[model samples]
Target: MASSAAPAPPAPAPPTPSASSTTLSSDGIPTLLTIPALGIKAPIVVTGTDPDGVPETPPFDRPDEVGWYGRTASPGSQGASVIWGHLDTPKQTAVFLYLRDLRPGAQIQVARDDDTEATFTVERVATYPDDSFPSDLVYNDPGYPALRLITCGGGFDRATHAYLSTVIVFARLTAIGSSANGSGTGPS
Candidate 1:
């Protein structure tokens, strides 16, 4: 004889913030991201979060591009701005492969659609298991401008087909400058 019980319900999805939940700058669309120390320069695209609240990243075919969480605060806005990249693709190292190598005090410059640049100074680098992602620290509004650069790190798991850990680079807003129609200083 079998028990006559219904299957358990699935867990609720993570919260997805509204566009108005965070302050958005007039030129919030990030056009480019450059990390001088890593010699990385890539175009940026706005990506939405999945139903589980995990940010969507660029497709494997677009390995050279980075993706910003579209619903989150803008890079220079009053919250934790997030950007992610693939560490590697099937054939080559991807856009953020060296993100974990960034040291505190390194510079990250984001050029926006309006031709202005937001500069950030790296504060810390941390690696955590994928299951132990720190949601509050990574996504909450910090009451000031901040940036988080994330990429796959640690070892690869053949069994799960995923990386064992995620590398996060936390940075603080340092300065904003005019890029003069995308011709600003810094790498192209």
Candidate 2:
């Protein structure tokens, strides 16, 4: 007899870094990510993994907070930079609810702490069931510097009463600009 379980979704395509991409060093922590198309701008704090190997989740589990993985690629670096947030709350909108509406070629800008700015272009938007999330391919890919903006998707399962999918926006860095004085800072 055939099994009733659904097959796992295929892994996401490998990210391709643009020719103009740049690598960020230790000085580039605390980058700011802005999506003009979506009218979203927020500061990113560099953090490390907790004991359970999970990166910190802030502004998701708690509002009014910002955090990013310190061990991962900095905003301008040539690897995947993973950022996540919640979908909704009991009262307010969450950071990434609008992320699913982003189309290919949407503009995403990152301003480094040193005053440099890097711009990226969204390439795709995909949704995956939460049970079979492609974590390794999404977060561990080494081919190019990528950005994954993630949030909950799909309808809330009446049985579980929770969202069943994850919305992911894939983007690649395409432009970099430095401060006139070479300080690598930019206007907030």
Candidate 3:
């Protein structure tokens, strides 16, 4: 029988903007996240490290929202911004179930609270065990605006029934405003 469980990655590169794309000053408080390639459009929620110092995730009850690690730079800002979601929940597939499928050049859009929307382009995708997560790469400043979308993947230990790895999609700010249609990769 097929396993009924969630499975479970990192960075980016220099941004190359097309003539029609308008690059913005790296900054914004993201309120929404949209990935056309996965047909994912979800609200963004702010989350912080737990008491034990591990980064917190979105609540399981609200699987529809993506968690923005509040300690990191805001999305589209001149630093790394992290957003993550559940790959799947016991009751249903969650918002980021397909996060592992994102390929290079995929586009992600963030509607920010600043009355502006920032667009990002996927530069790379990766997966890593939860114990070996690249915290530096995900949390360190890239000296440019960057976005990291993460979800569970890798091996699932039957004993725990939890995914052992995280899938990461790293992208850099490519443009801002209405002109950034986020038209690169369509839904798979």
Candidate 4:
């Protein structure tokens, strides 16, 4: 039987924090990314689309790392910031192997080179076939700081040696700087 529980309506994204004024005007080069809910804390590596226009993935030898697409908005910027990772290697599970397990309202923290972190709240997760991936929705600027984390999912094809679909986690910036429990020691 097909599972109707694949996903229900996602809980509303957590409200934007109002107590902190640490929002930066410019982009911050993301260095590290964390998802406490999933126990993921991985170093980020820069990548870009190949000449053929496919976004690059982390190297096979470094499957545990994340790839930040340089052509898109950096975290903390008012646009779509994209990050990607491998679902697995031929030999073992990789960094984003369990990406589909993340639920709405989960937090994703990206620590940047500017010493500030952009915290995003999960809005929803969706999956689509690679041939039908929504580029306009996934790549366009949404007029606010947003994030898109992508990876391969669904049944792996032995003939093509690839998964048949892409999993995307859409998030919106909900916190900046630092202050409260999720933040650091600042004036409260």
- The C-alpha lDDT values of all candidates are 0.73, 0.63, 0.73, 0.74
The sequence of per-residue lDDT tens digits that candidate 1 reaches over residues 1-188 is 00111111133233334344222363467889999999999999998756654457777788889988776667876667788898887667799988889999998988888667888889999998767777678877665678989888878876666787888999987777675643333222
Stretches of candidate 2 off by over 4 Å are 1-21, 60-66, 157-161, 179-188
Summing lDDT over every window of 10 consecutive residues in candidate 3, give the lowest-scoring window: 1-10
Per-residue lDDT tens digits of candidate 4, residues 87-149? Answer: 888877889988999999999988888777788889999998767777766777776778899
Q: Which of the two candidates, 1 or 4, achieves a greater TM-score against the reference?
A: 4
TM per candidate: 0.81, 0.74, 0.80, 0.82
Error of 1 at 169 (Å): 0.3
Off by over 4 Å in 1: 1-27, 51-53, 181-188
- Candidate 3 Cα misplacement greater than 4 A, ranges: 1-27, 178-188
- What would the per-residue lDDT of candidate 2 be over residues 124-169, giving only the tens digit for each residue? 9998887787777566755555677766787776565567787878
Q: In terms of TM-score, which candidate is strongest?
A: 4
When summed lDDT is taken over every stretch of 10 residues in candidate 1, the lowest stretch is 1-10
Error of 3 at 26 (Å): 7.4
**Number of the top lDDT candidate:** 4
Clashes of each: 0, 8, 10, 0
Q: Name model 4 segments beyond 4 Å from true.
A: 1-23, 178-188
